[model samples]
Target: MKEVYITKISKFLPNRPISNDEMEDKLGIINGKASKGRRIVLRNNQIKTRYYALDDDGNVTHNNAQLAKEAIEQLFDENFTSSDIDLLSCGTSSPDQILPSHAAMVHGFLKCDNVEINSPSGACCSGMNALKFGFLSVKSGQTNNAIASGSERISSWMKGHIFENEIKHLQALEDNPILAFNKDFLRWMLSDGAGAFLLENEPNGETPLRIEWMEGYSYAHELEACMYAGGDKLENGFLKPWSEYKTSDWSEKSLFAIKQDVKLLSANILKKGVDSLKRALTKHDLKPSEIDYYLPHISSHFFKDKLYQEMVDNGVEIPWENWFMNLSKVGNVGSASIFLMLEELAHSGKLKKGQKILLSVPESSRFSYAYALLTVC
Candidate 1:
């Protein structure tokens, strides 16, 4: 198998840091809510919240399609695009369409006829699975050069009615505000993001990273825990999903269930990840202690606990002391979690040659998907 290398990566976040305090003030979150662990806090205060970036014209710019284009454009500029890129993949949840796929949407923007595109919809695991497929494809010589971009549009998931219902519980207190600023954060913590990477086969020049090998395992039983049941937006964007006649039943079931679904799914996903890694490395007799860096999905703050527990159960030694949290600051970021982490590491100049990075992804629709080890060389 030919070695597939991650030659370059880039991330484009909306400028202007939105601090927790600022977010609370702007969104009207209060002391009781703040003290009740209602707000999502980032350990790194220097980290900024990411959002949809608008052009100077301020047009609520860049739907999912445009966002993909801008993200890829920045990545190409940062790493230098080549007309020779063999394959392009878009890993996304907010796909532009269910038919042609978001991969083709990005391909259309790039306007490259030479490359084949595939959009994978593995929910939050889109980034990991897409890149793993790219690496595996390159290893098999199907392509020498490839690009993977992971983008999420959590804004689309924000329904006004849902937001209103969630905030109604706050009792319209001007001083007592919403949790996590009492906006959409109360319903969901994951935010929006777009991250891209350029991968090549056999780096002929100076390179700091290479994808050594990758493998994934799937658990399909837990799909119900996280789901998007197709909102009421018509294709023409006319009728609202909930605009149909009101139902007769009027019961006050909690607007949201605090059931431990994400938490449970996190534990299950991490457990499967450990098993998959052990099985993959057992083929070459490697262990967790041999890894240099570990990058896993930051679904929620509790994810770290799940990872630690899984490592302990698997008897795997994790060399991570960095807490390595990103969920709250950028929200969940769905498919962009691992890829964005790599982009951040590259931005900070921390990714060095001869290091091993272990990546695992916990997804929504796809249950759990993970990668073993990708050596940097």
Candidate 2:
């Protein structure tokens, strides 16, 4: 069987680093005003600072395509041009336009011809989906060189007209304004960033990360609705069309309906994700003790203890000391998160040659999970 290796990783973060304090100020949240709830959510998420593709006045400076273009540009070397790329797989939760897919827009920006483009947009786990597509393309002898990229401009959308109107509507309707717009909580949790990885069928570069095994699982039927991106769910359980959402009054329904069932999400994510991880490990006949690092793309630090306990419950004691995260610095960049985390980890100079690493991404949008094992070579 042919193998695939990640030869390089490149990330691009915008200039602005929005701190919690800055976030509160931007939201006009005053002291002792929902302070307890704010503190709990922020502390639980373990997010101190996150980047935004915004200006000083909090206006969007860059969209998804531009961010992706910048990140992909960083992956190119003197010998590799846009023509060298056989496939471009881009995953993003928020895209610039509906017509031109994020991958196609990036392809246009790169001015490349004859390269295949795949833009898979949805929940946060699409990063792994993009990677899986590119990996299979190379592993199946269909392509020699491929680029898997993930980019997000979530901050701009979160702060856009729809959410702001929803916040106001909720505040007007409920006595406790802070808790009213509960679904808007993610506004403070997610930000902007983009990352890209160049994968080759052969070991073309020094210290390439070799892919050992990958697996995915989903438990979407476990919940009615947990997290969502487009269109509101109607009373009949069917999703409203985007055109209807655009044509109707915003007050009639939320443009982007999000129901983050904290209890359900927290309870099932770790269990489902750990089960998926165990299956991957077992398929490869590997054990927890063999992995030097466990890089998990958990959306919040609130799950840290639960995830650890879940692994222990499963009898696979991947120690907390062996695990590391960058969520505190980058927040959750949606589908771009795992790629951003991987970029920082790889460039930190902490990983060693021949060490085994496990990368897991658990997405709540559909209760989907993805797990991969990589060896530093």
Query: Per-prediction TM-score, please?
Result: 0.75, 0.91
Q: What's the lDDT for candidate 1?
A: 0.60
Q: What is the C-alpha local distance difference test score of candidate 2?
A: 0.79
Clash number for model 1? 3
Separately for all candidates shown, the number of backbone clashes (residues 3 or more apart, or on different chains) is 3, 0
Local accuracy of candidate 2 as per-residue lDDT tens digits, 125-149: 7888899899989988999979998
What Cα-based lDDT does every candidate model obtain?
0.60, 0.79
TM-score of 2: 0.91
Compared with the true structure, what per-residue lDDT tens digits does model 1 show for residues 1-377?
Answer: 78777877766565444445544333333332533433433442223564633333333445665666666776554345657678888888667566778888777777756678878776767777778778777888998877888887654444333334334544544433343322333333544568887777776334547776666666665334333323222345232322242431111112221112334344466666667666766775777677777777755555567668777777775766633456545656778777777777656666577777777666644456666466767
Residue 160 miss distance in model 1 (angstroms): 2.7
User: Number of the top candidate by TM-score?
Assistant: 2
Model 1 stretches with alpha carbons more than 4 Å out = 21-48, 53-59, 77-82, 159-187, 204-206, 221-225, 231-270, 322-325
